[model samples]
Target: MSRSPSFSRPPPKQFNTRRPQPVAEVLKRTDAFAALRAGVEQIAALEKDLRQLLPDYLGSGVEPGFIKDGVLALFAAHNALAARLRHLEPRLLSDLQQRGWAVNALRIRVRPQAVKEPPPVKQARMTPVGADALHALSESLAPSPLQAALARMAARHLRNREPKK
Candidate 1:
């Protein structure tokens, strides 16, 4: 005949004399959570102040997007405005940091704009020379003996063509 397996007796439970702590009390006991809450509250206040401080020309209607990595993204109508904002970024970031925003950087993006083409330049016209002028110059410049013969021939031709006056 097989014997039944024996089990060990369980330990006795102790009753708590004190009441359970409240959720608020528990959260307060954790320093990390408290610091996180304070940081979030400060960030909210800083965001509100920043919204009011931004210029109206930067588009008062749209809200600026804030990144968790401490980068602030803003949109500009064109490259000129974006460049202007980039120039002032250092000061803007410093101001935000002073207000406890903890911003690491600011980025401005330009929206597409129509580009204008420059006007065309006008050029001067070139004058044309006659072939008769070129031939006369060539005949006058013929070498020594040839030059003399051409000159005599030209003189005779001119004499024959003269009027009987």
Candidate 2:
């Protein structure tokens, strides 16, 4: 006793292959891609606005990098500016989060740019000493009465040991 076949005479073949499609063509029709572009533009605009409104606190110049997991990384000019921004991190994070930016944290880092010129070097003057200058110094260093008495005794002792002049 055998059952009769319904329709197919053989099993279907399976092919593991993917037809390559241009990325630009695929993105053109994606709503999610469009939303991503819009979000990027919005973030850029917000960053620009922040730069204009909070120049002192944010820094003279700021470059916004990737935003991930509600955190935004920004590049400042120097450590001083970064430190200032970090000091106000809580307020800045709150403000940005309030603006629906999903900014849970604000991290500021220093960006390397051009090196500044060092301050001018000061030249020191070197005065030459002459015999007259030495004489003036010797006069200024002349001994007091007690010192002169001691020096006279030393001179007398030395002269006594010397051959007659």
Candidate 3:
């Protein structure tokens, strides 16, 4: 006695059909995720404090970039703006402390914002000399699949050069 031929085949694998959970729900399960989220929220609060006190220091010439240890880095778009920010550092630090920020030191760096311009588009195509060379090569090759392919390519390149009817 033997099993049927169809019974010998392995069963199809099963897949879960449940919907995916939201990112916040997923993050709740991770300790590192919670800590990172808290750090980001703290930075945003510090940024808000800087924005609010900017006028009293150097107008809005400075922007918060990054924070490490007790130092908060600020970016100024020009040398003049950076110099002004340097002069306003003490007052800025004091204002930040008053707002409950733990920032103890400031680093002002000039980050000139370049005027963004679209890259010059280069419209490139096969030059007439190149096309002629390809045509000559195609003609010189012996009949084969490769020769046929080269012939088709040369024909396309020649057609590209012709003015539209």
Best by TM-score: 3
Residue 137 CA displacement from its true place in model 1, Å: 74
lDDT of 3 at 40: 64
Q: Give me the overall lDDT of model 3.
A: 0.78
Q: After superposition, how far is residue 73 of candidate 3 from its true place, in Å?
A: 1.2
Estimated TM-score for each candidate: 0.35, 0.44, 0.46
lDDT of 1: 0.61
Q: Write the per-residue lDDT of candidate 2 for residues 1-165, one digit (tens) a residue.
A: 447666734543332236565555555656879866666676667777577546564545667777778678888878877787787778777776666676777778889668889988965332233333433444565577755554554454444545786
Model 3 ranges with Cα > 4 A deviation: 1-32, 56-61, 114-165
Instruction: Spell out the clash pairs found in candidate 1.
Output: none
Give Cα-based local distance difference scores for all models. 0.61, 0.65, 0.78
- Candidate 1, residue 94: the lDDT equals 88
**lDDT of candidate 3 at residue 120, scale 0 to 100:** 90
* Cα RMSD for candidates in order: 28.5, 21.9, 16.8
Best by lDDT: 3
Residue-by-residue lDDT tens digits, candidate 3, 65-87: 66788898898878988987888
Candidate 1 lDDT over 52-129, as tens digits, reads: 666766433323455558887766667777777777788778887887676898877766545668777855322223
lDDT of 2 at 160: 50
